[model samples]
Target: MSSSITTILTKKSYPPIGHYSQAFRANGHIWVSGQIAADADGNLLKRSMSEQAHQICKNTSKILQAAGSSLEKTVKVTVFATDFSKLPEFNSVYNTYFPQKPPRSAAEVSRLPLDVEVMMEVVALVDPGDEAKL
Candidate 1:
């Protein structure tokens, strides 16, 4: 048996503080592992659910951009929050990043790392030729 998989990996901006990858690319798609509101140094960026969600989006964007892609190319997203109550606040911030709205789902988790309130992950198919923006 043989495999021709090209495992694209990046560890510069984000390291596995937990058990995850900041981002990886292969084939024609880039799979961005879950990103929290943590800095490159793996420190949680303190902010409200609104601010935290924004930071999470911003962080994800950076990882995508590093891989020659952007959120506009994202086809799917999943958000996990400690409570459904924070979702309202998260939405206010989420809309700021995704105005056009792509495929998405939200989950209420028992807890998140550092009790950070909210976290998110995304899947994106990128085309450097595409001019569409989100």
Candidate 2:
């Protein structure tokens, strides 16, 4: 790793639900923290599983952008949800955004805050050509 590369863990991108930056950067790669189904205002969105999943995607996209990356460039993601029954609907929303289909890992947990159904973390490389944005 080059010393020029560093980690930036700031709370500006997303509010700290517990203790975490919405995303961080290191070695030219950005590792996004798990973003819940919350809006820019950090308020939990109370909606159906599908809608909540969409919001989580939106939140993740924003965080990646803030780190000089894009959803299309994401290499992998980890999705968290409480209900596997919502998989079909969640996939519908997810596929719409990630048309290229990056690598992903998903899990069905027992619960999420605000009765939310979805959350996600993403990892992407900062395009060397776009280093100015970082």
Q: Which candidate has the highest lDDT of all?
A: 2
| Model 2 per-residue lDDT tens digits across residues 56-85 | 787777777777788988999888888888
The reply for model 1, stretches above 4 Å from the true place, is: 1-13, 128-134
Model 1's alpha-carbon lDDT is: 0.74
Model 2 residue 8 CA deviation in Å: 5.2
| lDDT comparing candidate 2 with the true structure | 0.77
Candidate 2's TM-score: 0.86
Each prediction's RMSD over C-alphas, in Å, is 4.7, 2.3
The local distance difference test score of each candidate is 0.74, 0.77
As a whole number from 0 to 100, the lDDT of residue 56 in candidate 1 is 84
